[model samples]
Target: MPRVSTDQLAARRQQILDGARACFARYGYEGATVRRLEQTTGLSRGAIFHHYRDKDALFLALAEQDAGRMADVVAEQGLVQVMRDLLAHPPATDPASADESSWLGTRLEISRRLRTEPEFRQRWSSHSAELTRATRERLERQRRAGTLRDDVPVAVLAQYLELVLEGLVSHLAMGLPADDLEPVLDLVEAGVRRR
Candidate 1:
């Protein structure tokens, strides 16, 4: 009977979004159901609908939240530092063990969901642009430092790098082995490295 305050509503909305993220990551957009979401959030259908008109809207919100989080993380690390961190924490293996199958499976599922969901695709594109710009800026800084090749166009190289990364992610999702990534990374490094 009583009306909820705006802050309470926002908190409840975030809880729903967090639940949606886990559901989508586990089952994907197509497989995730309203009932499952309700179960995950412990929210009634009416309450869920009150916050989001439908599943698609809820998914879009989730995608946007993910995009923002990714941007913040990347922004904090910078490109070179991020690469170093990634290499140090290679997605294919744990610190205590060499098994990367679990990590790869989770990435594959997220990639599949991104490709199939329109909302995800749109959010990915926008987020990718931001990332590309950040990378280009970093490359320019490297160029000034005489660490990057001066001959190639940075924008063109950035675009190519983005495409290559996307392809690699897709391939990894398709069960490509960790050993197979070396050649691809080598080629990409050769192209981008200073002569």
Candidate 2:
């Protein structure tokens, strides 16, 4: 066998991570095994372990990467754009057609693992503070722009918004129609709307 180039190694590592994401989403963290990941990615056990120290390390890296991608997607779309898209397009019946569905599934799986796996939960909890801070900034921007209510505490409002968004994602993952989202969005908007 010839030596793999640096680029090839990086690409293979990324493929492994992508395959791991799919496996975790499909089977949850506990069900995702290195053997299964090898089958999914067609990589040898040696290659997998060479790239990632262990299953937990691989999962933590994937989870962090997924979370970062989600934040980037939201930022690129902007909050208003994301809200408009959610209100307009809705989720697809087919999972492959729905990016949000995949995201929600991944998030729910990670959340479940967080609850059941102490080490994973600790890693996730470290990221939560950063997520909350970003959310607080977004809410503050809306409030300062006079789009959201100024009466309530920004931190409190941010927490509520975060919970609402999480709930909406969970509902959507369960195949609830986008039409079902309007009332909840309306309630959130009403609570935060400028008087």
Enumerate clash totals for all models, in the order shown: 0, 1
Error of 1 at 34 (Å): 0.5
In lDDT terms, how accurate is model 2? 0.69
Worst 10 residues of 2 by lDDT: 73-82
lDDT, model 1: 0.63
Sequence-dependent TM-score of model 2: 0.75
The Cα error of candidate 2 at residue 23, in Å, is 1.1
lDDT, candidate 2, 1-195, per-residue tens = 999999998898899888777666656677777787887668888988899999888888887776676555444433333454445645556534444334454677777777788977877887666566666677777778888787789888867777776777667657777776666676666787788
Task: Quantify all predictions' global Cα lDDT against the true fold.
Answer: 0.63, 0.69
lDDT of 1 by residue, 1-195 (tens): 999999999999998887766565555566668887887778888888899999978876776565454445445544433333333334433222323222222334446767677776765676556677777876777788887888988888777766675666565444445454566566776778798
Off by over 4 Å in 1: 1-7, 78-128, 145-147, 178-195
Clashing pairs in 1: none
Model 1 is weakest, by summed lDDT over 10 consecutive residues, at: 95-104
lDDT of 1 at 37: 81
Alpha-carbon deviation at 30 in model 2, angstroms? 1.9
